[model samples]
Target chain A: SQQGEEDPQALSIQEGENATMNCSYKTSINNLQWYRQNSGRGLVHLILIRSNEREKHSGRLRVTLDTSKKSSSLLITASRAADTASYFCATDHDYKLSFGAGTTVTVRA
Target chain B: GAGVSQSPSNKVTEKGKDVELRCDPISGHTALYWYRQSLGQGLEFLIYFQGNSAPDKSGLPSDRFSAERTGGSVSTLTIQRTQQEDSAVYLCASSLEASSYNEQFFGPGTRLTVL
Candidate 1:
């Protein structure tokens, strides 16, 4: 079973706008990682936030984790057409990762 | 450095036929993983291997699904008596180590179609 569930199954926004998606998990995790999938094929690792870490940033991406709530959110600032893809949140535990269904984001050009 | 690689970018077979999918992890990567993604669905963990230790097969859905990793570098996932529901993208990933702190590097998945 999937551990995480992403809110807002889909999102559309103009280029240069900010896009935000939320993920909620059912169990504890050692770390939470976000990945991006293009064309429903390969998924690329985006960023990871350990349970002890509250937030992390990488380029245009920002991630936050709240262990108490078992939730995480990913924010993409200044969205670009290239950034349009399905974003997924994965919870890592015991050397395995459970992924959420995903949020499909469309950056209108 | 090269990234993880998977072969037979796409495969189509009739039901009941056996199929094999291959994955080649990046050099020196000690941990390899296999996942399956159905249409519009999240990835489902299929199997995991770390170094020479026994693989964690806890996530495999059925007896027909089996995988093996050799020399801690290359891996193969095989499906016996394929079913229509078995059609999905098979993804392979490898991490530098087994630690949860390491991010996995993924391969361009192989799309499997069971007719």
Candidate 2:
């Protein structure tokens, strides 16, 4: 079974708007990581938040993790056309990453 | 420095044929992993190798799916007697160590089409 599940299979917003996606995992995790995939190719690492950490930010991306609820959210502020892609949340347990179905975000210009 | 690299960016094979996918992890990386992603789906863990330890094959779907890592640097995933349901993108990743906090670097992946 998959360890994580992303909510809202797809999302679309204006270029200047913000995009948010949530992920829920079934098991305890050491950390949660967000990844971006373009053209269904390789996945690019976006942000990682440790279980001990509640929030993290990098550039225009913000990640929040709530171990109590076993959920995480990724927010992309000031979205751009380039931000159009599929976002996935992975839960790190032991040494492997279990991923969810993912959320596809489209930023319309 | 080079990131993880995978071979045969794309592959198409007939059902029942055997296919091999290769992956080259970043230098000095001690942990390597394999994953499969179906269209519109998230990645599924396949295997994991850390240093000289035995690989964890818990995620392999069946006997037809196997993988090996040589000298702890390069890895290969093999699928024997491929089935149409086996079609998916094969992804490789590597991290500095097997530590839970370590982030992994991914390769472009090899899209395998089993017909």
Candidate 3:
């Protein structure tokens, strides 16, 4: 069974706009990681935020975790057409990682 | 230096036929995982391997599904008597270690279609 659920199952926005996706999990986790998958392709690791940390940034990606709320969010600043992909949030517990349903975002040029 | 790789990018087989999918993890990677993603659905964990230790098969849906890892480097997932419900994208991933902090690198996935 999956432990995480992402909101905004699908989103579309013009290029250069920021896209935000939210994920909520049911159990405690050691860390939460995000991944991007283009249609018919493999997933690419985006960023990982440990439980002890609250926020992390890499390039145009930003991830925020609120363990108290059992939720996390991913923000893509200044999105581009190439950023269009399905974003998934995964929670690592013990040695197993559970992924969410994922949010599909489309950045139109 | 290469990423994880899976064989047979696409497979089309009869419903009663058995199929096997292979995965070759990156060199020196100690952890490997298998997952299935149905059309427009989330990934479902199938199995995991850590080094030479016994694999974690708790996520496998049924006895029809089995997996083996040899030399702790290559793994194979076998589905006996395939069914229409088993059609999905089989994904393989590998990480440097079993720790939660390690990022899992994924392969392009094998798309299985049961006719």
Candidate 4:
């Protein structure tokens, strides 16, 4: 069974708009990480938020983690067509990281 | 430094034939992991290796799937009697340590197609 599940399986927005994706997990975790995958390619690491932290930022990406709710959200600001990709959330537990089904976001021109 | 790397970025094999996939982790990384991703599906844990400790084969779906890590550096995943369901991208990852907070760096992946 998978440890994490992502909501809004797919999303589409204009290039300049912002996009938000959510992830929920079932167990305790030490950290939650986000990854992006282009069509027909492997995943690329994005950002990681520790269980002890509430939010972290890097460039146009922002991630927030709420351990109490066992959920996390990723926000991509001022998106671009190049931002089009499938996003996944992974939770680290007991030394192994389990990934979610993922959210596919399309940034239209 | 170079990141984790996987060989034969793409492989196509006929059904019933055997296939071997290889992965080379980053230098000095002790933790190696293998995962399978089917089309539109999440990553499924396949196996894990840390240093010289016994590799974790618990996630293997069947007896036909096996993997090994030699010298605690390079790892190989072998599938015997390939099946259509076995077609997927095989990903390899390695971390500096197995600590809960350590992030895993992924390889480009070996795309395996079982006809």
Candidate 5:
């Protein structure tokens, strides 16, 4: 069974708008990581947040994790056409990664 | 000199044929992983290799799916007697270590279509 599940199967917004995606997991994890995939290509690692950390920032990307809720959210501020892709949240448990179904984001320029 | 790489960027094979996908990890990476992603589905773990230790093949869905890492650098995934249901993108990733905090760098992936 998949450990992580993302809400909002698809999202659309204008280039400069903010986009947020949420992921919920079923088990305890050591860390949560976010990735971006373009078309049929492999996923690119975006950011990773440890369970002890509540929030992390990279460039315009912000990620928040709530262990109590077993959930995490990835926020992309001032989105760009280049940011249009499928975003997935992966949970690390016992050295293995379980990914969510992912949220497809479309940024109209 | 850059990042993880996979060969045969695209593969199309008829049903009942066999296919092989290759992956090359970054230098000094100790942890390698293989995953499969079908249309409208998330990435599914297939296998994991760590150093000289035995690989973790627990994620393999069936006996037809097998993988091997030689010299602890290049890895190959072979599917025998492929079926149409095996059509998907095969992804390979490598990390600095097996630790939970280490980020995995992924290859472009090998898209397989079994007709």
Candidate 6:
């Protein structure tokens, strides 16, 4: 399977704290993407970082990619209760994405 | 603009029965994909369609799984003679094209329960 793996299967942080998730994948990829799922519902695209990109930022979300190690990390700064969800990292190759087992985040109100 | 849409948000069927899940892509998008997610698991690609070209079914797990896209817009996934293991959330996504750089827009998935 081309599917990747995400570490720290679960996380709990204060509403104002930060949450970070790491992902590692096998095989070459053109890009990697982060998605957020609320209560097992549909996934919302969070960010996409290409293989050549080392870091990218959007709002409170920061993503870093290290193609040399075939790994990436997502940082949600100053997370809120609304940020509680499952985060998944997918490797994009051949126009398809192999998703990783997500990291479930729980934010304390 | 409206995002992707799916029908029959939840379904429960017998192991020997069949089920169909539908997906509607964003307007003018040329790429559609089908995926399945077992409880507490990650997404598994089932098939992919680019415009009117033949779909890539390399990810389909068994012969009981099949899908079809009509007019490059809407798609349907059919599971025949389903087994208890077939229970999962079927998700659909659409992108502007088949490029790896494109971000896909997902639809609320259809939850299938095989009893």
Q: Which candidate tops DockQ?
A: 1
Q: How does model 6 score by TM-score? A: 0.97
lDDT of 6 by residue, B54-107 (tens): 999999999999999988888999999999999999999999999977998899
Write the residue-wise lDDT of candidate 4 on A2-107 in tens digits: 8999988999999999999999999999899999999856778899888899999999999999999999999999999999999999998866779999999999
C-alpha RMSD of candidate 6: 1.1
Model 5: docking quality category: high
- Candidate 6 chain A has its poorest 10 consecutive residues by lDDT at A1-10
Candidate 5 matches the true fold with a TM-score of: 0.97
lDDT, residue A71, candidate 2: 96
Q: Residue-wise lDDT of candidate 4 within B1-115, one digit each (tens)?
A: 9999999899999999999999999999999999989875669888899888888887899999999998889999999999999999999999998886678889999999987
Interface RMSD of each: 1.2, 1.4, 1.4, 1.4, 1.2, 1.5
List-wise, what DockQ does each model earn?
0.82, 0.76, 0.74, 0.70, 0.81, 0.74
Pick by TM-score: 2 or 4, better one: 2
| Higher-lDDT candidate of 3 and 5 | 5
Model 2 ranges off by over 4 Å: none
Q: What DockQ does candidate 3 have relative to the true complex?
A: 0.74
Against the reference, the lDDT scores of all candidates come to 0.94, 0.94, 0.92, 0.91, 0.93, 0.93
Interface RMSD of 1: 1.2
Top model by TM-score, which number?
1
- Which residue pairs clash within candidate 2? none
RMSD per candidate (Å) reads: 0.9, 1.1, 1.1, 1.3, 1.0, 1.1
True contacts kept of each: 0.87, 0.79, 0.72, 0.64, 0.85, 0.77
User: Which segments of candidate 5 are over 4 A away from where they belong?
Assistant: none
* Lowest lDDT block of 10, candidate 5 chain B: B35-44
Q: Which of the predicted structures, 4 or 6, would earn the higher TM-score when compared with the native? A: 6
lDDT of 2 by residue, B2-108 (tens): 99999999999999999999999999999999999986555899999999999999999999999999888999999999999899999999999998789988999
Q: Taking the tens digit of each residue's C-alpha lDDT, what string does model 6 give over A1-109? A: 5468998999999999999999999899989999999989899999999988999999999999998899999999999999999999999989888999899999999
